[model samples]
Target chain A: MPLGDETIVLSRRQAEIGFAILAGLAGFVILFGAMEHDTGWSRSGPEAGYFPFRLGMLLMAASGVILLRVLLQRGPSEPFLSWGAAKKLLAFLLPLIGFVLLIGPVGLYLAGAAYLFVAIGLIGRVPWLKSGLIAVLVPVFLFIAFEYAFKAPLPKGPLGPLFGLI
Target chain B: MVENFTQLMQGFAVSLSAYHIALMMAGVMFGLVVGVMPGLGAPNGVSLLLPLTFTMEPVSAVILLTSMYWGALIGGSTTSILFNIPGEPSSIATTFDGYPMAKRGEATKALTFAFLSSGFGALFGVVVVTLLASSITKFALLFSPVEYFLVFVLAFASFIAFGAGSPLKTIVSILIGLALASVGMDTISGSMRLTYDIPELIRGISFLVVVIGLFGLGELLETMQNPYAAKAVTTRLDWAEVFRSAMIWPRHYASLLRSAIIGCWMGIAPGGPTAASFMSYGIGKRMSRNGANFGKGEPDGLVSAETADQAAGSAAMLPMLALGLPSSATAAVLLGGLLIWGITPGPTLFREKPEFVWGLISSMYLANVVAVIMALATVPLFARMMQVPFSITGPIIAMICVIGAWTVAGAPFDLWLLMVFGVVGFVMKALDYPLAPLVLGMVLGDRMEDAFRQSMLLSGGKFSAFLGSPLAVVISSLIALCILVAVMGAVRRRA
Candidate 1:
């Protein structure tokens, strides 16, 4: 994961502009949502949306300024993400997404083990034996720590009843 | 003051138990591990451990967390001196002189100076907190909703003025946080504000979940993009040399005092430890007699930075306790923890939970000593721990983040929120948007809104309600001044 010379994937200028636009759009959505309820003062006090409505307006204003500044900027923009960096980030992130999604169906322990096995063995290129050991040991440790020691339950999913841990 | 002292003594009685002492030691050790790790910081470490504290008493929980904070601060400097990698952000300045000194075969001297000075700084900070705690709380007790709202304004305004980064970006970051906080239910009106009719949004967004995502997974992703090898400088600590280095503490008294004052001021003012350390380092370089030797390897440079960093880290706790305003991200998380534990921070907390307050304050005194000793004793152990490949630690950390998120409210939705915020955190970091303001915003959003709405109701929706009282007038003026200074500074920079 050490940085090396690589071609640009996203330029800083583009990122700035894109994110600002997205934020501005988010601001509009928030403002529109605020309008669903009264955004002004009522007989009791300020309405639920009063503070958020102002926040939404401020967000749009701030983001609009950012967008304008980036759009008008001159000279070279640095690379926001190089190709190699993006690839590396995705390699880690995609699996993380998979792990989170898997948690719903398989529970935390199994999902965690599966994620670690793939992450350490396949992506990290560690030897299978060590990766498998960590993959198994970590979830077991977490199960004990969370369940028995802390008395807090994690999502144990379908196999929970078999282990009687849920 | 006498009453405070009496309460403090009673607090000592509560915290001196074998069980509490053991928790302090365990916390420091765990914090050291977190601090010595690059991607895992004090805030993230504390939040990750928060779920476990649910079953513990508030006093015991606080002792553990605060001790961990002390350990992490000390642990961060270890990697700075040993590996030229700051385990925590605040220790970045330590590397300026700490690494160079270590490279010159004075590893023992550097570590000793860092540990001793940091210990002194933390002690000084805790003492300040102890002395000022009563007065500040008493003053805070007089605050009306107008003043409280102004306090929140002042906090954000100070960030724009004193914080490093674009003020607009800071504002945007804060707005995003406030918006996120407003999601789910409006506590005041009992209406849904920003949930977009989603069932998950009804519970409101938990700041803890966001914190885990931003600092935990976001930092991990950032590290993946630009990884560095951790090659530690191997050095055995000699007790005689350490004793000899400790002998020269008096020579740098001026630097220590100056840095400690700067650190305390920054901590209280919301500049935070990272900024305080950097500022102290810059000022030390200019003021010290050995100024030219700063980067190459100056003991004073390392001392000043480490002292200020730790001093600020401890002093930031004062405002969180007294004013219910968190000056740093870690403090904000601790404040959240306090909230979850059913202890509301403020002047009322002091009046209501004297045992909890004093116990925590007393623990600070004990914890720093324990942190310094533990840090010195376990350097080799942590140094070995650092060698564990990131490939293994990375996935383990991600798993911790997932587990942390799931446990916060046990909602599957929070896991997804964690992922979303993780990406947002990464982008915010890359874009140079200060994340502290956002965290602070999330922590204080509801409170600030409550204050504002209450004030409005008090004044029948009149805007002048904010300026009604003299105290409010003064705080409002300060907030205005802060924004003005920021705007002027921005204009001058552009010019």
Candidate 2:
């Protein structure tokens, strides 16, 4: 399981704590919303928040139990993954996230092309000739498939108009 | 029963049209591609195509989606055999014998046998669906609102008890799903509860975000970390050998039937294909003379896994068609597709839109045959696809994931939700929590809410009235029994 890199072990406790915190936060939001909206029964029937209010309480209780169990349990801590593996995952994830974020301003086609080029050329270390060809072709292929066949609209930057050989 | 048969035959006529047939092929092809590739799965793949189907006929659309479903199930076995990687969760058991067979240069034999068994299992499940459709509809009609509510409870309880591991974790995942389902404006009183005045939250979390993020992005992240070994596979397919393999498959006829039976029952009962495949494989191993060879390339092992996997896959659609209840993640997505098509799937659906229901069933039959043939013929094609570097595939998959999320609402905010849910999906996977229940919960949450609310109104808001009907009593008792067992298990563990 070693990936030939420095690694830090992530215990079950740390993961459980994070999950419990998430549950607690969700519980608080739901509880507050239920209270604000009123979970009481009206003349017709139950209020909108009635069932969710109870559900929120159950969620909070479950989180409490999880927190308590993690605190009490002495579980074995195993190596989660190597730093290299983690970096590999984050490498793709962060770039993809960035790609999505960039799509808003740079447009889908341009953003997509840039993401592919960089991920393949820089991150993957693939040859420029191969990566460059795929980068150019993919967005073009998508443009035809979605825009022409499906008649779907994609986000566009100023350069998007140039592809209007359509 | 005779009338149902006649209608199904008529449905064949409707679905056999050149246009619908083409759509079926397209659907199956799309399903196969995604099912073979890592990261993208049947549910997300179907969801990606769902928005495009708005202009198509409901019958054509449903046929296409269901065809994709069948193809995905068929496609998963191919990946399992050739690459030792299960493209779908249900195919995990196949890897034990399938990969071993491939390693021993029996890849063609194993693939042929698995495909044949899968086809046989699917056909058997479809026959069961066809014969039992009317009767099942009758049974479902007995359900009142209270009974409907209790049925959902029984489903959730069944998953929590029988899912992969840790009932408590399953419960937590289901609760997380239910909680997320409550984020949008409450439909009952027109009050936004969990939105916290955020306009984006008003529509609530889209299940598409959760599904694509979990199965698509999360799986991609997983693959990047724990990459599968790229093993060499023999792509030689000999007709004589394939025929010999098929001929000898009858030796496990009993196992095949038993697996199909197990698969169909589990599929209908909500255990789903993964559980059904494992159960069938386990039983086959116990019964076989070469039980010791189960994991080392036994043909019976391959047959048992494939048969049950395909059978359970096809049968999982039964509840969705009959009671509007989805038994699997892909089925849930199909359910969402149905809702979008403005078709309320219940007992009345068959009575109202007989053509659509029967056509879909008939298309299932055709799609099963088509998918098996296509899979067998294209094994080499998929084998090559297996060798394509994930570096190239990964970015393409990411792009598609982006398009899927963006197309859902045509908003940047939805992409952010997709990313958020992607991280949540990754964490959940690491935590060993069963995710199927979460997706199912979100899909059924709205329907369950309506049933619970209406039942309260009908009973004058009295909780005791839930036990009035015999059907309701039965379902409630079932739920109570499950909870009791869970509690007893907990108490025993504490001691």
How does the DockQ of candidate 1 come out? Answer: 0.82
**lDDT per residue, candidate 2, A55-160, as tens digits?**
7888888878878887888757665655776688788987887898789788999899999998887787889999999999999899888888988888877777
The best candidate by TM-score is 1
TM-score of each: 0.98, 0.97
Scored by lDDT, model 2 comes in at 0.85
Off by over 4 Å in 2: A1-4, B488-495
Candidate 1 residues A86-165, lDDT tens each?
88999999999999999989998999999999999999999999999999999999988888888898988898897793
Per-prediction DockQ comes to 0.82, 0.70
CAPRI verdict (incorrect, acceptable, medium, high) for model 2: medium
User: Model 1: clashing residue pairs?
Assistant: B184-B201
Tens-place lDDT per residue, model 1, B16-85, is 9999999999999999999998778888899989988988999999999999999999999999999999
Please identify model 1 stretches exceeding 4 Å from their true place. A1-5
